[model samples]
Target: MNCEEATKLLDGYLDGELDPITSQQIEQHLRDCRT
Candidate 1:
């Protein structure tokens, strides 16, 4: 995922509102990205 998408989803991630697959993707994205 790109920065924009990840940023948009960050609130959901923090709130635990996203699905497992999407959360995993976001986690992986965070791991790959310096942000």
Candidate 2:
């Protein structure tokens, strides 16, 4: 997914609402984005 999509999903992740697959994707995105 793209950055915008990931960012949108991140909120759900923070709130513990995302499913495992989406959460994993978001975690990977966070790791890649950490500078």
| lDDT score for residue 12 of model 1 | 98
Off by over 4 Å in 1: none
* lDDT tens per residue, model 2, 1-35: 66899978877999999999999988888778754
- Clashing residue pairs in candidate 2 (N, C-alpha, C atoms within 3 angstroms): none
Give me candidate 2's TM-score against the actual structure. 0.76
Alpha carbon lDDT of each predicted model: 0.95, 0.85
Clashing pairs for model 1 are: none
> Lowest summed lDDT over 10 consecutive residues: which window, candidate 1?
26-35
Off by over 4 Å in 2: none
| Cα lDDT over the full model 1 | 0.95
Error of 2 at 1 (Å): 2.2
**Tens digits of per-residue lDDT for model 1, 1-35:** 98899999999999999999999999999999976
